[model samples]
Structures are given as C-alpha cells and as structure tokens.
Target: MTRPAATAFPTPDDLFENAPCGYLVLSEDGTIRMVNGTFCRWLSCARAELVGKRIAARLSVSSRIAYETHFMPLLRLGGASHEISFDFLDAGGGAFPASVSALFCPAGEQESSIRLTVFPAVQRRRYERGLLEAREASEVARHSELETGKLREQFVAVLGHDLRNPLAAVSAGIRALSREATTERGARVLVLMEGSVQRMFGLIENILDFARARLGGGIVLTQCITDQLPAILSQVVDELRATNPDRVIDASFDLRTPVECDPSRIAQLVSNLLGNAISHGAADRPVRLSAVSTASGDLTVIVTNEGPTIPPDAMDRLFEPFVRGASSGYSEGLGLGLHIASEIAKAHDAVLDVTSEDSVTSFRLRLSAVRAS
Candidate 1:
C-alpha cells in the first residue's frame, strides 16, 4: 500500500485570519487591542490603523449610544452577551446591520478584555421592511373599497328618485284608457298592464328604501296617537287580497287601545309580511294576521303561514338586505321587503322576531303604544 499523506491542520493564527465572520478583541476601555484579517477587511482598513482606535469610532451614532448604554453594561455583569444588534459605518461612510455576540474575560494579572463576533443581517432587515409595506398596501385597498361602495349606493338612490315621475305618468295614462269603451280581450290586456305597472312600482320603492337606509337615513316616521290603526291595517290586507286573489288571508283585530305610530309605515310593514306569506305559504292553508293592544300600552301584531320550515343556517341572515329564502318557489321581488320591515320596526323601537317549525313560520312585532312625551 502507498504511504498515506500527512493530514494538515490549520494553526490558530491561520484559522483566525481566514474566518468567515468578523472577530475583534477590545480592552475594558473599548479600545481595539487586536482584530482578525476578516474584521479589518470589513472596515476597509489595515490592522495597524484600527489596533489603537476606539471601537465606537467604527459605529454609527445610534449604535455608538446603544453600545455604551446597553451592550457594555450587560457584558460586564453577565460575562457574556449574545445577539446584540448594531449598525457599523464602513470606510465609504455607508452603514450595514450586524448581529454581535461578546464574551468578557476578567482581569487576573493582566487587564480585562472582551472577545466579539459579528454576522451581517442585511437580508433579515430587508424582509421586515417588505412586510411593513405590504400591510400598509392592504389597509389602503380596504379603505378604497368602502368609499366605492358608498358612492354606488348613492347613485341608486338618485336613479330611483328620477324614475318616479315617468312611472306616475304611465300609470295615469293607463287609468284614462281603462275608462274608455273596449272589447273583452282589450279589457283583459289593460288589467295585465295594470298589474305589471304595480309590480314595477313595488320594486322601485324597495330600491329607494334600501338606498336610504344604507346611506344613514333610517326609516323616517311621523308618529302620532291614533285609534285608526285597525283601519290602516285593514286597507293593506284588502289591497293584497285583490292582487293575490288565489290566496286566502285571514285577518282579525282586537286593538282596543289607541296606539302611537306612523300609520303609513305600519301599513307598509303589514303589506310586506302578508305578501311574503302569500308567496311562500302552503297553497291550500290560510295565511293569518292578528293585531292586539293591551291596557298597559303595549301592542302586538303577528302574521303566520304554513310552509316548509326555514333552514337553521338561514335564520341569522333572513333580515339582511337582498337575502331571500332558498325554499321559495316565487322569485318576484328584490328580497328587500323583510329588511325594510325590520328597519321600520327599529325606527319605532319595536321588536320583530321570526320562528319556523313544524311546517309553520311566523313573524311577530311588539311595541309600546304610549304616546311620545
């Protein structure tokens, strides 16, 4: 066998000079007593020029302050310090981040000294800066989205208001033509046209109300004490009965005490609830509406219908704008009726709640009937 070559090992001086990281030895007074070749190259200076200089001279202003106030005290007390961050100034006056660790050797027969090692941290600082910029960009995007949504809602409100005049003109012309003599087929066509116009009017009303509530003008009510609430509610029932002739609506009133409320708004709320019942309730079952007033100045109105039970997951979002029941076979409206009704109840400081079970669904409203002082 050939003789094996001798294994060469690096001596202490060779290892110190060619190390991957910067190394330095400092006296207790912070003067640089010794430095490795790696450290001298990092500062772009010769060993002779740095050996007698203070280590503070190579640090940036803030780092110099931190070194004296924080780093030196910890190393003296604990005899070792790890991962202290600082910025060092190069010969070109540029700064770079560095992570420093140091070990203190106490004095015995010679002066005390500290041995330090430094690693560059340029990549870590760059990553942290990138994270901060991305967070700021996300916040700006969210704010812009909110502003755009508000502008769109305001546009809908304006459009709804502008459409009312032409709709009213068309309705007036239809009524004038209905009064004139015509064949049986012509009369039936006129009736169909009238129904279409009524449906369009209902849609426009819902859109306008939704826009107003979203724009912060909640339901505007004119409240007063009146005994005519029963009559107002009766008129709403009659109107819906005419429109949905195939559906049976049972209404009963026991409103003995006068109630304080906006009559028109109350009428509208009842109309929405009744129409919902007619659309979703079982065809052969009667939709029920009942109103009662207590002597202690409290009022209650309930509407009940027999239908498929509402899904549990959907109950929470039923009153949210533009949300409709998934089980409904009728898809005629914009799904704003219940939301508007809830808003009206809130304006009156009333409680409106719904429950569906055993093939029955009911919406109940309760409010104080006392006159406002």
Candidate 2:
C-alpha cells in the first residue's frame, strides 16, 4: 500500500461568511437566513437591506422569472447549474450583466435547509463585451469593403458606357459606310465593328448589375411558377452553347410547386454554380441540374458535375470571402459569387449547400415555396 487516503479538512462556518465569492443559505420558504459580505457588496445592498429578503424581491422581473423558473428548481432539487447569465438592475436603473453559478446543499438531515452560492463573472462578462465590439467592427469592415468594391464596379460601368456609346456610334457609321462602299473590305470592317459592339454590350450589362448592389438596391424578389424556369434556363444555356460548342447542358425541374424568388438573382446563383462546375468539373461530361419540391413546402435545386472532392476542413470556409476550394478554378472569379449568392438566398429565406465526394461535386439551392397568387 502506498499511503493512507487523507481525511477532507472541514472549514469553520465563519470561514464561509468571508468567502471570496458570494454565498447565501435560504430556507425552503425562500427567505435568506444567512449570507456573506461578498454577496452584500456584490448586490450593492447593505446587510440590513438584504437580510431575510427574498431573492426575487431584489432582482428585476426578468431575473425574478429566471430564478423562479430555473434557479429555484435547481436549488430546491439540490442540483447544480453553472455559468447562468442575466442582467440585474439597481435601484438607480443601472443594469449590470452578470454570469452566475449555483449549487444547492442540505444543512443537515432535512431538505428544508437550502444552501445557495453565486459569484460575479466580471472578467468573463468583459470578455463577452470585447467579442461584441469585435463583431461590430468586422461588420463595419465588411460594409466598407462592399462599398469600395461597389465604387470600383460603378467606375467600370460608367467607363464602359462612355466607351460603348462611341463604339455604337462608330458601328453605326461603319454600317453606313459599308452600305455606300459595296466592297469586300467594307464587309470585313462591318463584321469587326459589330463583334466589338456586341462584346462591349455584354460586359457593360454584367458590370452595371454588380454596381447596383453596392448602392443597397439588391435583386428584388418575386413569387414565380416553376413552369417559367425551364425556358429561362434554356435561354442562358443556349447563350453559353453559342460560345462553348463542345459543352452540353442537362436541365430537369419538378412542376408541382412555385417558389418565392428573384428570377434574375436565382438565375445568377445557378449560373455561377454551373459556371464553377463547368470550369472545374470533368470536361466531356454532362453538367446536370434538377429541381424538385419537398413535402415541407421547400424547393430544392441541385447542380452536379462529375469532378473534384473538396477537403473536410475547407467546406466550413468555402463560402467565406477569398477562400477558394478545389472546386473553383485557379483564375476563375473573385470569390464573391458564393457570398453574393448566399446573401440572395437569405433574402429569399433559402439555403445553399455544397458537397463533394471522389470526383463528383454538387451545389444545391433550397427555397421555401410561395403560395400561388
């Protein structure tokens, strides 16, 4: 045998009275029969004021209810609850946020003796305040970042418009000159001018929409039927096919329900997901899309491609700004599409999820159904 177990030393009752933390012993009727100096000072009440008083009588109504509903049971049942938090209001209307913990004990053989303990968490509470401040500062920085990005987009849009107006004029002038020249050289000039004008138009449209969001004018939402979705997607698909002759799009959607959505924003969300998939997913394979209504009045749409498995840890930060996963191209986009799409989804009370395994990756959009109007 190593050594005998040491007997637990017991402190005197007076030692408890001078405890560093607050302490009180209450009767079953909720009368404070004994307390320490720490509690009296912590509550900012005098001994005469706190003596024989009910805990609820001093606390605010909310605190009182919290005590009655939770604390009372915990104490009465001789249970322990830790780190319970609430606000206490003083007589002068000064509110103090506090974290408290309590344990109940029997004084003797009878359960009528209820001993309770409470302590102030000033340091922890101060840390919580610091966290709140940091969160607010982060929000301010995000807003500032968005504002700066919007200014850049707006500048680009304005410049594109100024340049395009002149290009359009020159294209028109070239067409008129081609009509007068009636030669092969004139035809080639007309073709080049028309191609340049079309390219400029597309770039300007994308930039203008991105800039409008910076001014707090987001994509407006509407309730639309599922029937209209196929045609809308077909239009985008046809446009993509014109440039990428090697790629094919497969679209499937359920016809059973309508959804609350902003059509253009929803389209943009899908287009980005699909574009990302096409850029990273296995080439020479079909990129698939499908939508269906759930029994819970939710609509779920999935875009899947047969390529890439994202790492476990990366999934958590995938939607975060500037964090790119294997599913994204090396020089694809600025990492804002998922962020913007996520905001759009929130505006519609929707959810977006990305999952990958082996070489198959899927992005899903889930939206609540809107009543047909």
Candidate 3:
C-alpha cells in the first residue's frame, strides 16, 4: 500500500472565529484570553468586553455555582472536562441553555491555558417544549371528540323516542277526524292533514336512519328473496304523486328477474329520489322514473328531472350529509335525503350516481342481483 499524502487542514485563524460552535481560549485561572466571533455573537457582546474578563462572571447564577464548585476543581485535577451543561446570560439579560467542553494545555512549564467549545441549545429546548405541547393538545382533542360522540348518541335516542309518541298521537287524531268528516271541504282538509303527516313521518325516519348510520356501523338491510321491486318502486311513486298531484311523475318498469334485496330499503331509496326531484325539478316538466333489469343480473333504477343544472363543484359533495345543492332553486328539509339514499344504496351493494347537464339532472342506482352466499 502506498503511504497517504498529508491532508491540508484549515488554519487556526480560519477555524477560530468562524467555527460552527462558539470557541474560547482562557488563562489557567479561567480569565478569557481570546474569544471567537461565534462566541462573542452568542453572548451578544464585543470581543474586547470579554477577553480580559473571567468567563465565570458571564454565566447564569446556577451555572456559575456549578462551574465554581464542580467544573473548576475537576479541570484542575484532571486537566479536562467534557460535555458539561450550563446556562449563559444573553444580551437581553435572559439565560439560554448551552453545553461546553474544555481542554487544558500546559505551555513550557508555565501556567496552563484552556480551550473551550460552547454549543447553544436554544433550538433544542424549544423543539422539546413544542413536542410536549403537541402531545397535550392531541390528548385534549381526542377527549373532546369522545365526549361529543357520546352526547350525539344520547340526543338521537331521546329525540327518536320522544318525537314518535306525539307523531303517532297526531296520526290517530287525523284518522278519527277523517272518519267523522262528511263535507267535501272537510275531506280536503283531511287529505291535506294526511299528506302533512306522511311527510313528517318520512322526515322522522330519515333522522333516525341518519342517527343510526352516524353512531353505529351504517344502515342495516334485511335482504330476502322477492320479485316485488317494481311494485315497491311504483308504490313509492304513487305515494309521492298523491302528495303532489300537480307535478307529473311518469314511471316505466321492465323487470324479468326475481331479486334478492331489502324491499323496504328499495322503496325508501326511490321515495327519497322522487321527493328530491319533486322539490327541485322544474314544476312544469314531468319527472321520469325508470327501472330495468339487465341480462347480466343487475337491476338499475333511474330518476330524471328537467331543472337548472347542478354546479360541477357541488356534484362532488352532493351525497355528503347535510349538504344541499346550490342551484336546486329551492331550500328544504335537513339536506339528508340524498345522504340517506346513498347509505341505503351501499347496504344493498349498489352504486348511486348523479349527472347534470343542459338543465337536466338524473340520479341512477345500479344493484347486483347475484344471490348472496
């Protein structure tokens, strides 16, 4: 092996003033001999102010005590000390943390000199404190979310229980009045009452379902073998038509396969879509409902209405809970209808999609009819 050439190193003058850490040279009695730019800048003082002064005089009270009682004696006995932590007084009269390492050198039988490297630890201290605060804030947020969830569950339970009792009593009273009404005007009032009650019932059911989906796993479906999907959808349309006789709801169905699904959920899904269309669609145009079964064992339901097109930005969040359409031309309910319909579609393993263009909006639900094993 060839002997390596001597490597050139930076001169002491180059390294002393511009070292990464603060550098100092002191007399044997601990008076400063020379100070670097880094050391002087760290103390926010000029080199002249520190050169003839004792380094211990610039230390914080506690650090001075530690230096006088422990460090000075240790250096005298062992000729060196390493990694001693202390505090330095800054220009603002506040103390900042620092770590120091010092080495002693004897010069020709004369008094020894000391060389020290000082590392300012302000950033390290700030980082440690920041980490502690972040952990505490995370813990507080987690606790708050837990409490909020518990309160939501309790409110949902109480609301569903208390509101249903009064609603049932109102329904019973309406039925009694309907039986006694003998005039056409009274009969019309009873019809209006019936429509109002049905709408209220739908709203309450939506609230309960929304609560269950939020607090529990999701909407639960009771699937069974049934060939009544068209009938269920037709019934939903008829009910909505009854409530809004002026708006035309044209429905068409072609189903050739018996489906395995939750009939009530399917009906609810159509009901929600129909209600949305009736509320937002152009009043003068007919809302169309179509259901078809494909040869590949899939059932599809499509609801279309002519209305102002939904904005592209709004489409992404259309199915989010409590989000209402911006261009729907009307405000209604809690904006939970589409959200509940989406959850019902998920329970049936279906895809629900919406498209809007040229002042027409369509919602489609496609369900796989493959029997569950």
Candidate 4:
C-alpha cells in the first residue's frame, strides 16, 4: 500500500482571517484592536483602516446609542452578551442590520478585550416590515367597505321615499276614474290597473321597510292586546285573493284569545307569506292558511302550499334580504317578502320557521299570547 499523505490542517491565522461572519476584538476603552477579513469586507474597508478606529465610529446613530447604553453595560456585568441588534454603517454610508454577540475577557496581566461576532439580519428586518404594512392595509380596506355599505343603504332609503309621491298620484287617478261610469270593458281595465297599483304599493313598502331596518331603526311596533287578529288576517287573505282571482286560497281561524302584538305589522307579514305561496306554489293546488290560538295564550299561524321542495342549500339563507328561491320561476318581487316577514316576527318576539319535504313547503309563525286584562 502507498504511504498516506500527511493531513494538512488549517492554521489558526487562516481560520481567523477567513471566518464566515464578521469578527472584531475591541479594547475595554472601545477602540478596535483587531478585525478579520470578513468584517473589513462587510464595511468595504481595509482591515488596517478599521483596526485603530473606535467601534462606535462604524455604527449608525441609533446603534451607537444602543451599544453605549445597553450592550456595553450588560457585557461588563455578565462577561458575555448574545443576539443584540445593531445597524452597522459601511464606507459608502449605507446601513445594514446585524445580530451581534460578544465575550468579555478580563485582563490579569494582558490587556482586556472584547471579542464580537456579527451575523447579517437584513432578511428578518424586511420580513417584519412587510407584516406591519400588510396589517395596516387590511384595516384600511375594512373601514372603506363599511363606509360603502352605509352609503348604498342610504341611497336605497332616499329612492324609496322619493318614489311614494308619484305612486300616490297614480293611485289617486285610478280611484277618480273608478268613481265615474264606464263600459264593462273599461271597468275590467280599471280593475286591472287598481291591482297593478296595489302590487307597486306593496313593493315600495317592502323597500322602505328594508332600508329602515338596515339603517338601525329596526322594525318599529305599536303593540296592543286585541281580539281582532282573526279579522285582520282574514282581510289579508281577501286582498291576496282579489289580486290573484284564479288562484285558490283556503283560510281557517280559531283565535279565541286576544294577543298583544302589532296588528298592522302582523297583517303585512301574513300577506307576504300568503303572496309568496300563491306565486311559488303549484297553480292547480290550493294554498292553505291556518291561525290557531291555544288556551295557554299562545298564537300559531301556518301557511302551507303544494310545490317543489326547496333545495337543501337554500334553507340556511332563506331569510336573508334579497335572496330568492332558486326553483321558483315567478320573479315578480324583489325577494324581500320573507326577510321583512322574519323581521316582523322578531319585532313581535315570535319565531318564524320553514320546512319543505315531499313536494310541500310550509312556513310557521308562533307568538306567545298576552290576554286582555
């Protein structure tokens, strides 16, 4: 076998001069006594140029302050300090972040010195600044979105209010014409016009109510204990029947107890539910409305219709404003009827729920009763 060549190890001076990080030795007075090639290269200066200078002279203002106030005192007490952040200035007057660690050697007979190593921290600093900027941008976007929503709701409120005057004028003209004598054909035309006006009025009311509720006024109520709930509900059914003469509606009332609630609002809610049923329910089948008052002073009203079952995905968002049923072909209204009805139910402290199965859909409203004293 050939004799193995002698293993050549790196000399001490070679290791010190070619270290991966910046290295420096400083006197207790803070003058640089020695520096490695890596440190000189980092500052874009020669090692001889940096050896005699004070280390503070190479630091930025803020870093100099931190070094003198915090880094030096801690090293003197503990004899060692690790991971202190400082910004080092180059010969070109540019600055870069560094993580510095130092060990203090006390002088017994030799001169005391501090040995320091520096690691670059540019990437960490950049990452921290990016996180801060992203958080600020997110907050600004959230505030702008809220402001835009408020403006849109205000526009809806204004538009709804302005439309009422012209609608009232049209309704007045129709009524005036109805009072005069007319041929049978003219009478039928007048009736159709009246129905159209009523529908427009309902749509306007829904829009106004939606705006009011969204603007924080909520659904205002004038609650009273009344036995006229059955009559009020019956009138709602009659009005829907008048508008849809060809559709069949069956209504039953067994309200034997008075309940404390907003009568007009209740009528509006029932009208909305019945109208939805008439529009979306099967045209050949009869829509049913049942109002029952229990001896325990609770009131329940249910509206049922035979139709295609509501899809499972739509059940969660059924009461959200402007959400319409995906399967319903009739698209006459703004899809606010169910939403307004739910709001009315909340105002009365009642529960409004729905179920659909086996080609039938039902909406149930339950109210706790308050009998007249």
Off by over 4 Å in 1: 1-127, 183-185, 370-373
* Candidate 2 residue-wise lDDT, 1-373, digit = tens: 1222333662565457556677777776678788776666666666777678876676777887998898778766656767777665544556556666766665577666566656666677899899999999999999999889877877865786677777778768866777785678767666666655554554454444455555566645665544566566666566555444577778886735554456776777776677666767778798898877665557787989886677788778777644554544456455655666666677677889888898788888888675333
Per-residue lDDT for 140-194 in model 3, tens only? 9999998898788669756976788898899899889888937999888878888
Model 4 accuracy (lDDT, Cα): 0.89
196-221 per-residue lDDT for model 1 (tens digits): 77767777888888899898887899
A best-first ranking of the candidates according to their TM-score comes to 4, 1, 3, 2
lDDT of 3 at 15: 72
TM-score of candidate 1 to 2 decimals: 0.73
- lDDT winner between candidates 2 and 4: 4
Model 2 / residue 19 / CA error / Å:
29
Q: In each prediction, how many residue pairs overlap at the backbone (N, C-alpha, C within less than 3 A)?
A: 0, 1, 0, 0
Model 2 scores worst on lDDT over the 10 consecutive residues at 1-10
Candidate number achieving the greatest lDDT relative to the actual structure: 4
Q: For every model shown, what is its TM-score relative to the native structure? A: 0.73, 0.47, 0.72, 0.77
lDDT of each: 0.86, 0.68, 0.85, 0.89
Model 4: weakest 10-residue lDDT segment is: 1-10
Candidate 3 achieves a global lDDT of 0.85
Which lDDT value does model 3 have at 27?
A: 93
Name every residue pair that clashes in candidate 1: none
